[model samples]
Target: MRSDQPNYDVDPTILQPPGTPVWVADEAWRELARAAARLDRAVVVVDCYPGVDEQAVKASLERVFDVVVSVPDEAARPTEEIDALVAANLGDDRVFGYITQFNVADLYDEARLAELRRRVHERTGPIVLMGWGARLAAPDADVLVLADMPRWEHQLRMRAGMPNWRCKNGDEDILRKYKRSFFVEWRMADRHKQPLLDALDYLLDTTISADEARLITGDTFRSALDAAITRPFRFVPYFDPGVWGGHWMQEVLGLPGDVPNYAWGFDCVPEENSLALDIDGVRVEMPSQNLVLRKPIELMGPGTFARFGADFPIRFDFLDTFGGGNLSLQVHPLTGYIQEKFGMKYTQDESYYLLDVGDDGGVYLGRKPGADFDEMFDELEKAQRGEGSFPDERFINRFNARKHDHVLIPAGTVHCSTRNTMVLEISATSYIFTFKMWDWDRVGLDGKPRPVHLDHARANVQWDRDTDWVTSNLINRIDVLEQGDGYRIERTGLHELEYIETVRHWFSVPTLRDTQSTVHVLNLVEGRAAVVESPTGAFEPYEVHYAETFIVPAHVGEYTIRPADGAGECATLTAHVRGTEFPRSVSGEDLRFSGRSAS
Candidate 1:
């Protein structure tokens, strides 16, 4: 049975080395004071991610040091200058923004930074420098600390009237704020943070409220990130409601009913999700991207890591539309388009694997036979200008869907899932790049019109993919690969042009599997529950219930999966990059994972 509360935490008890101290609440502040006592004149730099409570960090540091300096406030460029600088990248669009290549130091005033440096050198006792770009003020420090927060947490704080790093636009539109973060601030912050994380002495979890916070030594924190990829693990999942949301997740996952409906279940978005690391007894939550950035080879394997360094290519998420409205008609950019336009290496080439289908569940896919492209574009432009409503049926074809149906949706393909269908979207990680052609005349839950990118859609939509071509190419393109006693395997595709390969496995008995030197994502599509464990008892057995997505890291080279006792006929849908392969060795003992094997 599906557990209301699923497991996404990674403990790595056996793998963890001793002497990792976890300081919480008041103890966290005290530990910094204790560390400062060791130095004659301590220069502790608390480098922060934007949107973290810089004031609270400064207040806490004052309890440890004689004085705390806000580096960004003292030396950073004015809010207006920062805004004007990024205006070109932010663009005039309500949804899209081109990625900027500027570094965080670009926003700092060099004269002010030099002046702040002179003042800091004049101090005698312990000093604390706190703000987004504190490290820029003092490259060499007695102790370095990172006050961290994730992108999603930043979004929550923004919606609650919190502004960006140095801006006073607290009452700005949430989408505009997000666009700036995604296109401007986040890219710059990440570029600034990568080197700091490697040389850090401490990491403070600033996402938590002021009453109770978590802190750990950088060694212990880095060790935990290394320990995570040695076995199977999952990132913490987050859910959100939309105008076209559904009731399945709210009921099945036992989510709060306060929201109108649950539109998305973010199971494996590394950039936006977090991971809770168990350090002895305390829970330390950190962004999953930290692991991706730190250990790209072990987590993604050499194959995918070579193609996309520090970028998590594969993504899995849930789209719940049951008893709600249809998703907006959308198309994603092709790889060349994404690379040239947005500075991304790839695009959102995705597939919808139907997990649950209600009576009226279906999808709008491909163009109708002999549909006039010019006429459709004209109608879309007219609808955007409020001249008339878009007639979707005039251009698109509707296909009835069923449970366990897998449909491939490569970039440039026109597609949209309808109401009453639960979709598990297995795709590339760049989901934010989707260009909406129409929104079905529906407004968002906030009573605002969702932004449509008809111009971008016009440049990318595949006009060649007609109804007949879709039937032959994208829908239910399954091939029987292998079968044995109490086991069967089939290749469920993501198309030839797409890089991701998918397969479905059904087994009542224990089935041995190999990771093929690459990361693999799986969801329990059928039966009640199943357990994934090391083949030679390397890692502890991990249980997954129905509809829960789990990841098998590339370092876990070999593993086994079987239905739990009392559960029957379990099945899983697996996804991975296409070219990652490891030929079976001819002889010798199996190379199972161990605590000693972890980095």
Candidate 2:
């Protein structure tokens, strides 16, 4: 079971030695070496060793590994010891690699630590640590352990206080009583090492995909595809959708696993296509809703908007086999800059009316005051990469989304639907938004990847935004005074950044408010309503649909709408411009009124 060779998952309790000068205890060292043997990999213990029983431990570990031990003697140079182990183990195809433990705290001064890294990396193959020496000596080295540092250090005090800081709060006594230590042991070899590395490097440097290179750029499609599917690609599941009865992802997309939703733009989906794109909004739907949600529209070429818009602009298909699971996350463009910069077809402004959830499910929203953006982002980068500290406060503002609970998510807000929650999403016509942060770093079953938008998200993040411990400061507690049978306005705050006001009536209602030229995206979150053209006007139900959206085409005259039922409440959310910079339009005039124009 040695990781250097091949075996099952390694036991983690071997990290702390049993007896020592707060160093490698005999018992702990044996456990670690035992776990390494189980991994079929020789272990590398990088430490200033004194308490470890080298003779007894070596005999036990040798039984499992073709062991090349590197415990630098006082006279032996660290480089020489490393070279000997590397040459011995790497040369013998049958032998698993070495278990290296250097008293780095004393053996190497700063100069020697640097020298050790250069020499060690020169040795072929991956390296694992028995202790935390490499992180201090060579902070950037690709190192892995079963668990994170157990406690907060004075140096990490600032981050430790931050909510998003990956600072673990656990005691050794508590861990010892438990069966396993936090340390991890897994295979670290790449079957196609050189190819995977080269492909990753190329992807980091290039923007064009494989097919685009042949027609326009010189990008090799075969190479990129090969890189994407390389084995040893890590898979971590943040949450299990299928096991949770109903999941948030399936609910929001309004999909039934057996029956396809035609509005999602797909016709007669194949059985194989079911499992791949089952989650929603993906071409690869799978039977399990545990599908990855990744969109590479940014990499798509120009004129993509025109072509995509002609078909389904904000297209997504999802299956809710069992029902009662929904999602609760809303999105909006950062500031009307999306279409202006990236283009119209690339904005994601949507909302959710969560319908159902298991008793435990709830949505986690924006960061708390303690979890600052910079701190959260840093911890996320490290934790996701399995490199830095671990954030203890991975869950925040997670609330249950009962049926009919309406949440309007504008751009810049952080949110996610929990594992078991069903919700409806009413959104803008343009569908290009992203979750800037994620508490979990698990990838899905896709050999491909779940894309993270840490870079593009910067433009949309509201840095100074804060919320009450319970809800956002923007959640307006307005006093709704009924105006008339055909009119009611629920004055809600988009706050200073956005606005959400609900206009309702029996069937036909008229209001004389000045347009101020701000274009509004109107959607029927409840009963269906229509904007009937005035007598002698061009289009009836101008920008009308029962699906989800309609625009208050600027300069349209006093309009009338009869609800489908004609006498019941007809509701629509009026998403209007928020800042002083947006233009204003007078009623009945079309001059300065421009809304969602094509880029």
Q: TM-score each candidate.
A: 0.94, 0.37
Quantify all predictions' global Cα lDDT against the true fold.
Answer: 0.84, 0.33
Assess candidate 1 and give its lDDT: 0.84
lDDT of each residue in 286-326, candidate 1, tens digit only? 78888888888899989999889988888889899989989
Badly placed stretches (over 4 Å) of model 2 are: 1-362, 372-375, 386-395, 401-411, 419-436, 439-445, 454-463, 469-472, 476-482, 499-520, 528-547, 576-599
Best by the lDDT measure: 1
Clashes in predicted model 2: 66
| Candidate 1 Cα errors over 4 Å, as ranges | 1-20, 586-599
Clashes of each: 0, 66
